[model samples]
Target: MHVTFPGRHGADPARAVDGVDLDIRPGEIVALVGESGCGKTTLARSLLGLVPPTAGRVTFGGKPLGYSSRALKAYRKRVQLVLQDPSGSLNPRHTVYDAVAEGLRIHGYGGDEQEAVAQALSRAGLRPPERFFLRYPHELSGGQRQRVVIAGALVLEPELIVADEPVASLDASVRGEILALLLRLRAELGLSALVVTHDLGLAWNIADRVAVMYLGRIVETGEVERVLTAPQHPYTRALLSVLPEAPGDPVVLTGEPPDPSRIPSGCRFHARCQILASGEAERAGVADACRGEDLPLLDGGGRAQVACHWARAVRT
Candidate 1:
């Protein structure tokens, strides 16, 4: 998928998701990681036809798909989304069984409702399926409710599932169980998943590959082991620095990112980048030499793609 913004404006008048190019292969788990507002969710939404790119194209099964009514409906059936909040995603009035069965009905699956619900419940770890069938969203605990949401998407048997921070709201103890269930579902169904999250550790645990985004574009993408262990982009380095480490770890970056609306010019991350532009006063200080340069997203060693002119220097 190639996504671009032609003078796009976000909630803050800056293009939240700038030009982004990515692909999710079947049976592969791709993790999109970044700070909030980096367009991780927006990229996911664009795939689902929720966010229309101003100047780009999305191809599924080697065919182009715009955000048209028919194409979107078809895309939706093959690509399901599991939201972050089960409470918000599920209809409060509907029972667990109803929520799970909704997808089957919409897709015109005229099979046994009872059997499908049981299977979905089992897959989502809500075993002893009878217990959850009659409960409403409000009646179930946070974890259980999230399971219900998963069951709804899994029941459809989609080729791809976009989980947008599916466990962000759950308790830490229950978070593991949910992640386990997701892995189990992928294994059993051979389904591909795009997990959107800011937690690099979580991505390390689950994703086959990782794509690091910043200021609406993917700055670094490669095999999970390569990118996380030895990040090419300076932005990726800063993100890794803040992660929990062993005792006596050194402090990393200094401050927060620049404002998105008034984004730093040339390289979006040059303002916060420590290695990319150290000597150039205009690039280093607030004078803004880095503001005018546009760096292409280039391929680097180890099959990793990076978007920084100084990537070679940083990598070496």
Candidate 2:
């Protein structure tokens, strides 16, 4: 999928999501990781139908997404969004009960509204759901507010939840609780999720699979263990190398990611690629290709793949 916007102040159009492909299966969690401005949120928005891709299409249940208001409303019932900030996601005045029931009311649910709200709250790890119904957002703890957000999504009983930085705003201790809640929800509800985050540690802990994004495209992907522990792409390795538990010296990328409006040629990551800079590609006889050959995009399937001329040449 490709999502672009007219460039700022009459510059070229900025490509927020460019030729990216990803999939989320039932009960599975796929983490999309990258630095800020790497287009993770845009990709998630495209899947949520808030931003239509300028090229390609988003599909759910093997069918193409429709942009009609009715179809989108129906799709939203099956796929919900859990935003990054609990403080911003909830209204200051809406009680917990009202907040969770908002989706039900909008969708014109015919079932017992109160019962559904209670079940969703309990499922989201807010046990004894009735006790929190009368409470306001300011009255709850950060973790609790996040739970309420999850409960909002849960109330819809969605097949998939596209969470954008689910725990980034919570306390360190609270992050684990929220993550555990998501894992438990998947186990008990068979729910799938596309978690957009920059924290590789969070992805390593919760995701079944990981896709590393660079600029606007996936540079590497595999099972969490393989991708996090044995990253093949220089970008993935650079990210992991800075973790507290990671071995070796950190790879400090010199500059911010290239502006999407002016993505570099060949490998989008080549300019900052440590492998090429360290002469590894030269030894492998692909240094010239690294500067001139654009690696093929990943098929976005369930297999290990790395989009780097150097990595591919070494593997072959």
Candidate 3:
């Protein structure tokens, strides 16, 4: 999907998605990673036709999307979203069974509602279905509530799922459970997923592909193994360095990423990048250089597309 700004409305005009294009194939999970305010959520929303793009189009199976009433209903059925907060999505008065069955009711699925709700709950890892059917949003714990949200999405039998920080608020112990559920769902249902998250760990654990965004622009994207092992963009490397690591192969990235609204000219990451230091290297460091030029997507092997002029050297 491509998104641009004519001018700033709620989002900063200077900070806008430019030529943002990526796709998830069937049964694959693509993780979107960036700092807060990098427009990860905006790009995700654009895929489902929730956010209208000012410059480009989004197509699924080669058909451009139209946000009209009919198109929206079709898109809603094909794509589902799971928000970070369970309480925000679930009604306090509705029981778990009602919440899970709500989609079937809306879509007019002529089947046993109870059986459908039971299957959704089972798919979401809420075992002994009866345990959760009667519970309210407030009655369930954070993990269970998040599972309910997942079950709600599953009940619709969507082809694609957009998960925005699915386990962010859950306790550390419970986080693994939620992640496992999502992985299991992807395997069992053959669903494509675009999960938006700020946590690099989450990406490493669950993503088949990774997209790194900075200042509302996608600076790097590649297979998870390649990008995580050898990042191309300075912004991506910086984010990775700060994350916790094992002792043997410690990699520390330097400097903070630039702010979105006040982005730097040429490359937004030049301001805080250690790779661009003048005295340290006549040319740019491993992944530096091209400061005054715009880097388009470049092939970096294994169906990986990265956007850094010096990414080749970085990968080596």
The model with the greatest lDDT is 2
Among the numbered candidates, top TM-score falls to 2
Candidate 3, superposed: residue stretches over 4 Å from native? 5-12, 246-262, 278-281, 285-289, 298-302, 313-316
Candidate 3 lDDT tens digits, 40-139: 9888888878888877788887788888988988889889999999989999999999999999988888988899899999999899998888889998
| lDDT digits (tens) for residues 80-118 of candidate 1 | 999999899999999999999998897788889889889
Q: Flag regions of model 2 displaced more than 4 Å.
A: none
Q: Candidate 3 has which clashing residue pairs, if any? A: none
Cα lDDT of model 2 overall?
A: 0.94
lDDT of 1 at 53: 72
The digit string of per-residue lDDT tens for model 2 on 149-243 reads: 99999999999999999999999999999999899999998999999999999998899999999899999998999889788899998999999
Q: Which structure is stronger by lDDT: 1 or 3? A: 1
What lDDT does model 1 reach? 0.81
lDDT of each candidate versus the true structure = 0.81, 0.94, 0.80
